[model samples]
Target: MGVLSGVKIIEMVGLGPGPFCGMLLADLGADVIAVERPAADAGNPRPWELCSRGKRSMVLDVKKPGAVETFLELIDGADALIEGMRPGVMERLGLGPEVCLARRPSLVYGRMTGWGQYGPLSQVAGHDANYVAVSGALWLATQSGQQPDAPPGLLGDVAGGALYLAIGLLAGILRARQDGQGQVVDAAMVDGSAHLLNFAISFLPDHYGGSFEKARPAALGMHWDRPYLCADGEWIVIQAVEPKFYAELIRRLGLDQDERFVNEQRNPAAWATLGDELSVLFKTKSRAEWTRLLEGTDTCFAPVLAPEEAAAHPHNIARDIYKTIDGVLQTAPAPRFSVTPSAELVSVPPRGAHTKDVLAELQINSKRTGDRGQATAVGSPG
Candidate 1:
């Protein structure tokens, strides 16, 4: 059993962050019931969809008769309902928070969206980049001010949207447990992405060397905190922020002979020159050579590894951070506990994979268009 073993969630199937939030809850052992559309790929569902991992699936096409009531029946037993629909889509379908909260007084209604429930742009369509751009987080992508770029959806979708929504649902659950009244949690990606800039915003004055114009380069270099290309074209990064760590870095690189670096480590004026010097110096050795020299020391150093490389790294292997299950390479469930630990790798259920079992467990008779008459599971529970 996990820490959240008794918690139950109704996950309305949608794109991106909604399913991700469900996966996180499921990883912590929530009894997540995914309400999906009719299985178009009923016979050939992908079992490796990581975002839907560790969840039971039940098909609920609301256009069909009595489906909405069936959905409400699931909500009655659930502690939370998470959906990544637009602002008013749930209400249009007659399954809004107001309706759900009436049926289940303590149900946490989590609404995930890029622009949130209100404001002018709430109804407007947007993806990760747009939300990050509007939220000022895209500016932090200052790779020396060369057009900010990041891995797609990592910032806005997963980090900002899904993560914040998960926290909001958890908080709302606690609140409902205290007072039998639930509320809507509007987790906006734009708001959460802006909140993510707190570290940069709070430290801007102390870090930018008293010059706002220097912030870009400061972000790029950040007191010797940057990636360097090695002789073999692979990369290694370092962030020796403190003077003593800087001492250790250069000492390892045999650059202790230089007074310009030794005496003037913290001066903002010297960073540009130091970065340039290191750029030249790092190219002289292979990334493997540098990793051997700097892997375990306190220089805050690491190689720029790809996902496959990261999964195989010694440290990651030692911690069991990544696992390959059913030919799928994915990270293990995280934030482990000493008392009630999270589960290991959880399998992704096929669409409507648990329909019969879940309905039987809830004691709700379900109807559908299928020849099976009763709500037979669409496919094997792969």
Candidate 2:
């Protein structure tokens, strides 16, 4: 059991962020019912849909008769409901916040989207990159002369979208329990991405002419706060942002005596010159050599390890941060608790695998469902 042991949630499984939010809630021991499209791929569930882990899935085609009513039955008994359809889809399907809240006065309705409900772009379609790009969040990843790019889904989907919705739902549920009222939470990747940039914004006035549109920020321009390539072609990073840590970095590297490293740490004038020098210097040593000399020190150093390498890393192994489940490698649920730990990992299930059971539990009957309910699905995920 986990901290959210008794929480009840109904999730309308959609793309990326919505399923991820559901997975996170389930990981914390919420009793989650994932209402998926009837056409989802049950015969071939993808590994990344690890988002299905610990969730009980029900397949219901809202287009079919009695489907919306079935969902309402779930909503009536749930503490919260999450959905990621385009702004009006739920309304069109007759499962909007107003209707659900009427059914359950204290139900938390969480919506995840790229733009947000009522925004100019809310009804439009978008993916993770477009959301961050429009929010000015992608500029943080831009380096000199490089196009803005990042690992897909991390910034906008997982962080800005999924995580924000998860927390928003939890907060709403808490308030609902106390106040006996509920409201909808509009969690947009655009809004959350902009909020996530607040910390980097603090250093903006001294960076790139004080605007993200101009160029990279100050930290990227720092001599000691950059990635270096080793002779063996592996990459290593050091982000000694503080002065004392900067001193530790150069001293450990025996560059304290170097004239270029002697200047004030924020001196942008010295960055390019020192970067050129350090680039050549770092290439002289393999990553292993630098790991021995500087790793586990105050230099804020880390070697860039790919997923498999990260799983094999000593620190990661010691902390039990990564594990293989059903032959797919993924990180463990984060934000460790000293008291109630995260629930055990559960294997992914076929889509709509529990449709009959769920329908039976709710004693629901629709034209599309029978005593045994829908069969295993073979279509792709939504």
Candidate with top TM-score is: 1
lDDT of 2 by residue, 159-220 (tens): 89999999999999999999989999999999999898887777668755687654464344
| TM per prediction | 0.93, 0.91
Worst 10 residues of 2 by lDDT: 373-382
Query: Local error of candidate 1 at 203, Å?
Result: 0.5
RMSD of 2: 2.9
- Which stretches of candidate 1 lie above 4 Å from their native place? 41-48, 209-213, 217-223, 368-382
lDDT of 1 by residue, 1-382 (tens): 6789999999887767888899999999898998775545333353326888888887766655676777788888789998877878888788888899888999999988999889999888888999999997777755555878868998999899899999999999998999988999999999999998776666667877554445553453544777899999999988788888988998888889999888887776787888898999999999999999999997779999999999999999999999988888988887888999887775677777887887777676654434221231221110
- Candidate 2: which stretches are off by over 4 Å? 39-48, 205-220, 365-372, 375-382
